[model samples]
Target: MATQPLIRSDHLFDTVELSKWELEQIMERAAFWEKNWRPGQAPFAGRFAANLFFEPSTRTRFSFEIAEKKLGLHVLNVNMEESSTTKGESLCDTVKTLSALGVEVVTVRHREPEAIQELLTEDTGCKIINAGAGKMAHPTQALLDLYTMKKHFGSLSGLKVAMIGDIKHSRVVRSNCWALGKFGVQVIFSGPESMRDHELEKIASYLPFEEAIREADVVMMLRVQLERHHEQLFVSAGEYFKNYGLSIERFQTMKPDAIIMHPGPVNRNVEISDELVEHPRSKIFAQKTNGVFIRMAVLERALGGVQR
Candidate 1:
């Protein structure tokens, strides 16, 4: 990749929009913050952040809430069920209301990728962070995943990552491709043929699942995302696992130092085995743990750190 100019946006919506240096800065800051974070530090003191999640989430939403609280920022968590959207209010009105409430930054996770972007204006007066946006991008998740890999290996260059399962509907995979590529990590895809994204193929290579696994330093499994697909991508769940899932027996074939990873709510015995969730090499839980620190870094950066 060619050297790119510094990113000029305060909002983080897509990994591909950020320069490699910006991503590195966030990862390094997260690592430093994780090691040195202290209570009442208040990097984002006197600022207000709102977490508006239209979609269901476990880690991303809670982690941002925790990060905001830890940073001593005023935090408002909007439950969409109770919001005016239930009364037919538009996303624009909800944001306008938050802006009127003096929010300094907003983090959103909506079903439509473009919904959040459409809310931006010349004088919106608040930073925007993309938590998860459709199947298009989940920039924060990819950032934390990169941070996890960097934490383990100390560098990302020369690493090979095999992304397995439900590639077409996975925002995690989409974001990781752009973020990981910036670090010079080799990324390959594997899944049921019906689940492969044609757009992804223009930039990435496909290999047999087993072959991809054996050669990778990290095997990152994605959720099946059956909720988004109307058609059966595979013949059956058992058959999918049998042909494409990560089993203990197959894990034994991987490099001794290679790691297993999953962005959670894992489908045990489907994309990965149950025991592997707690396996020595599994970084799944660690990814969730790192999410808070990474989010803190993002929040601070978005709000202009402690200086503002």
Candidate 2:
């Protein structure tokens, strides 16, 4: 009888390191799994995986758990509040312990910008999937965003994307910039000047708020990170909505084919008006739906025998 081939360990850190071909494979696989995946279709049956989310989350955390369960892995959800970390045990120590105990994949969301990097270097038996690491990266989120856009437009090439709202201090922006740049997408940045980060200025052109919206094929409104939105002048929620948010007037001028997108927990009437959240053209919910399938592809890629 033929023996199964040995698989190499891999990590999905930031989409910056991903090539176009690799991205295509993931996108293709995600679509395939979305159409074909059935209940209890467990490919990684009996293998173990752990979610070590040091920071709070909702969609990303739950999506990972759902994907892990669907993949047939024994899932361990570590509550940092109750975990040994409260007893002074280090994160690396906990991860190493899990690896020793046969955990084969660890999905982590941490606040330290460099914490995930440290784990990438450690020679553990399990794969490291960076759920989100501070403002550094959120690869999985970008993947699903890409999957959503592609599913809608059929291709990302030559599409124009307006990434509005808080740009600085957004890990999602960093990952999206890296992933979307590969597909010939014209990513323009616009929002309150205070929210703009200069480091990413070179890759994306800064357009005036209105011009960016009117000309784009996809209008992706980012959530205003209230904690990080440190503007020189205090811009109140109502003022921001009128001046910068996607109001009804602005939405009226948008191209008929143009679609609205947001990585949500939306500020309702702040970043986008309440009426537009579920608007005919909004892909916000579609992005959330695509998130699950995209994660299914990512989790399977990590634990389902892909080479490093």
C-alpha root-mean-square deviation, each candidate: 3.2, 3.4
Q: State every prediction's TM-score relative to the real structure.
A: 0.94, 0.94
lDDT of 2 by residue, 176-269 (tens): 9999999999899999888888989888999999999999999989888765544443358898898889999999989889999998779988
Model 1 residue 180 lDDT score = 96
lDDT of 2 at 252: 91
Count steric clashes of candidate 1.
0
For candidate 2, what is the total of clashing residue pairs? Answer: 0
RMSD of 2: 3.4
Judging by lDDT against the true structure, name the best candidate. 1
- Residue pairs clashing in model 2 are none
**Candidate 1 on 163-224: residue-level lDDT in tens?**
99999999999899999999899999998888999899787899999899999999999999
Q: Model 2 TM-score?
A: 0.94
- Scored against the true structure, residue 298 in model 1 reaches a CA lDDT of 85
